[model samples]
Target: MFDGPSSRREFMKAAVAVGGASALSACMSRAEEPIPKGTDDPSSLPERQHAWNDVLVHDDAGNVEGPRHQLLLYVNLDHDGPPTEDDRRVLESALTTLDRAYERSHEGLVYSIAYSPAYFDRFDESLPDDLDLPEPRSLAPFEDPEFDRQDALLHLGSTRADALLEAEEALTGDRDTANTVTMESPLTDVLAVDSRRTGFVGAGMPAERQDVAGIPDSKPVPEQSPLFMGFKAGFAQNQATEDYVTLQDGPFAGGTTKHVANIRQRLDDWYVEQDFEDRVAEMFSPRHAAEGLVDGVGDNLGDSSGLTPDIIESIEEQAKQYGRVGHAQKAARANRDEEGNVRVLRRHFESTDDDVASLHFPSLQTGISVFEEVREAMNGTDLTSNPAIRQRVNNGILEYIFVRRRGNFLVPPRRLRSFPTPTGE
Candidate 1:
């Protein structure tokens, strides 16, 4: 039901944000391709719930393309204290219903459930000694973000708009069936949904939704830009491997720590004041702009952001000289381990939730400390001492992005995914 030139593109984006039976019906009517069906066997899925790279669609340059639409369900348990046996069964059946209803891919559906530190406090036992899942906190001297202390977070994603919406409706008891598979149980029966956050990515999406508040009315978003910031991020070479982020030993082995940050964007200055060259300098590095490294939305950089050791190490000097530093260049400082492997797997997406521009940044790592360290690096607080680099000015995209909320969670292994205990047994 869209009427004009950009109807199909805008309809798909809006349908995901406005999820329910009506949105699904509107989307289904316009669906040009049929969504793939899921498997009957839960055993066919991977042990790591965050695992999505293999099934993700890859670009011509070999970069993994994230799902076009995503939904985050913030839920709270119905009862206090530890969960009961029947509660576990109800949650498991609801999850397994999703497995049977859709394939675990971008075309079908990919999902993961994570528990907050507040949820673990309900138990007498503590988390395993190996896991470092501290409660969310303000990382920077300037930021004062509200902490998200919900019991659980359910992340659902797919390229098909109808599939993601249908999965949500099915899980929340809005529908009895999903993809023609009768759902055995609904997650809402065991957990109450506190909030629903939605987002989208992939080329042409940002351009289609630029009429929102954060972006300028000039409509400068490029058609190929996957992010609202006008560049591609989470390149394979720049990201931590799934194995690197997985907890290797402990009761929670194969599990990982997740840190989600909701950042609000006010980008009128980003597009109006700064030209393309200035943006490239702030997003990548002044050297990148000087050398002409990033061509148009950074698609030319291939599978990585192309931040070398020299480029990352020179942020200070660049700040002193050019009066600005790049966001990627500063973050890369703490992004690597002693062995040079990347630290955190960042799966960030753009959102227009509440009619405001924002980003849902979900990062997975072996421990929450690793993510905290990387975020501290991204904050670039040390460089603030320099007269040229203030907190929000000339400090790499910080001038436009504001941290609104933050939360930390422990994503258990698939075996313990359903109402897992602190001990993971």
Candidate 2:
């Protein structure tokens, strides 16, 4: 059962980050369990490509447990003008190979492909009127970030480290077959891979990889915390449902828009200068800390982050009395719709890529404007009117995180995922 030294397991996780044929080979040598195979009928898959929660595993408390390993392939088309029919066929066949080789689950592999605004700019037509995907811009006044304008983005996830690496090799033509399914076409045949980003998440993972640039040597990451921060996030009640984020009126009716941000975290102060209660106040709310509502890693809170209407509405008062506001409380202001339903479905995961502590924040919504509004609220600019709150101090977790890059993409429906035009034709 893949048992080995803790160092060996940690090395396997690092191999996913440093992905290649060599890394995949090294990782496969340690696999004890047989990797599961997928169905042959690709047409039977779900319509919405982002509909992954049903396939993912859940904790005893019922919160969706995300895949442990993740890989993002950023690629641009070789030829500029709209892709040829041959290009589409090659891309479709490569993607179909993946579908046939692995089940759409954490144990197998779950993936999605998205297109950028720059990608649609090549076409003479425009996207549907109902879609509100705009070019990404600096959300916070204090920060400037490089925008990712690559033609397309492909996200792959799996609980097995070996499965994740092997999939990468297959997509890039480095392997003959995946899960014993012959790969007739490779994505690299039509698209040029610009860059590859990899990451891991779950209990004990952050702790094992804590010997990185941003974290302190004290090794303070809790064994139960899924993230580098000592708390759980993406509570089921706190997130928008998959249907809520899907496009309803456009030709891409089953599709959604995605916004991804790379946030670099410097947690020396989070571990050394701040105490548990104070950290809770910044990450959650002062009321949560004062009420002793959160246990270690916030597992006691269950499926929700405990941000009720009362807690969210009390942000202004709490900021005035406690001299601080929680990150979730601030964002919850603009996160809900007029019907009081959540707006964005955040599927963020932690990363030790480049030997630095960072978070790859991917939020799915019907429109990019919704994500921008929620992030602006997270900035707590409105709270900064008070003397106690500023851009960084007592506002939220912004003090410890830096926004490095931002990108917005349109995740078309499964049928049109190959090379969809703006009109969905």
For candidate 1, the 10 contiguous residues with the lowest summed lDDT are 1-10
- At residue 292, give the lDDT of candidate 2: 87
- The alpha-carbon lDDT assigned to residue 392 of candidate 2 equals 94
Number of colliding residue pairs in each model: 2, 0
Model 1, 88-118: lDDT tens digits are 9999999888888888899999999999999
**Clash total of candidate 1:** 2
Clashing pairs in 2: none
What lDDT is reached at residue 208 by model 1?
83
List where candidate 2 sits over 4 angstroms from the true fold: 1-5
Q: Measured by TM-score, how close is model 1 to the native structure?
A: 0.98
What TM-score, computed on C-alpha atoms, does each candidate reach?
A: 0.98, 0.98
Question: What's the alpha carbon RMSD for model 1?
Answer: 1.2
